[model samples]
Target: MPHLTCTEACGPDELQRLLRPRSDVVVEEPDHSTPEDAPPDAPAPEAAFRAVDGPFHHYRRTVHVLERHDEECLVRQRISYRLSVPVWGWFITPLANRELRRPRHDGTQPFWAPAERLDPRAGQVLGVLCLLSVVAGYLGTLLSQTITFAFDEFDAGLATQGNTLAAVRVGVLIALALVVLADRRGRR
Candidate 1:
């Protein structure tokens, strides 16, 4: 299995066409974009995982083996490049050693395959329960303070107690918003 890295101009279909004729040719897609292929006009292979944080695009490109021999397999090799467009071409290979290092696949399944049923409501319920717990905790704290503290002291502590409750409410609001957004996206 010969691992070959081609330019971004080479599409998967084109690469497959190039390798399909040959029995031993193995093609591995690159992980990142290059200088010549920066403009987004060039054809880039679809990646499995993608994330955008700050100014940089963080992601991993997964190239599944289309064809392989019994003993050897094809793997995609990607070179990460930071694109400033039409300017400097900075090649960034942050985790070269770690990226190259792959775990050995023994090709055997574990004894117990515990399948999980994902209830859609479970996550939302958990988030709501957590929010309720936080609110309950704040209420409990306030109730405890009322039992021990003088009336004037309790009045002074009310603002501080309210702040804590507000923080929890804000957190719950964010969680609920996230859940609602996720639910909408899932429906789409």
Candidate 2:
């Protein structure tokens, strides 16, 4: 693919537009660990971020060389996805899972979750699930806080936004009920 040239300096805003030009794609928790004490022979600055868009959710590591070759910078992106198997990827890729689950930088791993590994204790699973639900609810609230713009786009009146959210709640209920039923009934 051809590289993009920005007229102004390449800042975070410019990188946001250049790297991901999609409205639906949201890159979260970007880590730009550029070492200041590194020597001149050190490698270019690398950036790692979690991109969650549509059906594709993965972590990407991009190396953007600051050097100019013909006044153009070269960017190389590498993606490491934990799930790569055909039907059930989580069960297939044991080595990749191990690498992902391994402890990294100060007991903190970026965008990594121990999803497949579950404690057999029912109470423990319930506690974890409850915490997850709380986190998910907080995120949902954050999304709803900014949803006024979307509501206005649909010619939202006083009740429009409320009604829309109520509809979403109902949809979520139905969807979750279906999910519970699907596991019991078996869906292809």
Best by TM-score: 2
Q: Total backbone clashes of model 2?
A: 0
Tens-place lDDT per residue, model 1, 1-188, is 11224333345554454332111111123335444435767444444222231112232333444345555445453423222111111221222223222311332222221122112243235446656778878976776566435546656565776676578678769988998999899889
CA shift of 91, model 1, Å: 33
Each prediction's whole-model lDDT (CA): 0.39, 0.47
**Looking at model 2, which ten-residue stretch has the lowest summed lDDT?**
1-10
Identify the candidate with maximal lDDT. Answer: 2
lDDT of 1: 0.39
**lDDT for model 2, on a 0 to 1 scale?**
0.47
Per-prediction TM-score, please? 0.26, 0.28
Report the C-alpha lDDT of model 2 over 11-105, residue by residue, as the tens digit.
45444443542222122355565434447796664555554321222334344535445445444443344332233343334543343333232
Q: In model 2, what is the error at residue 31, expressed in angstroms?
A: 43
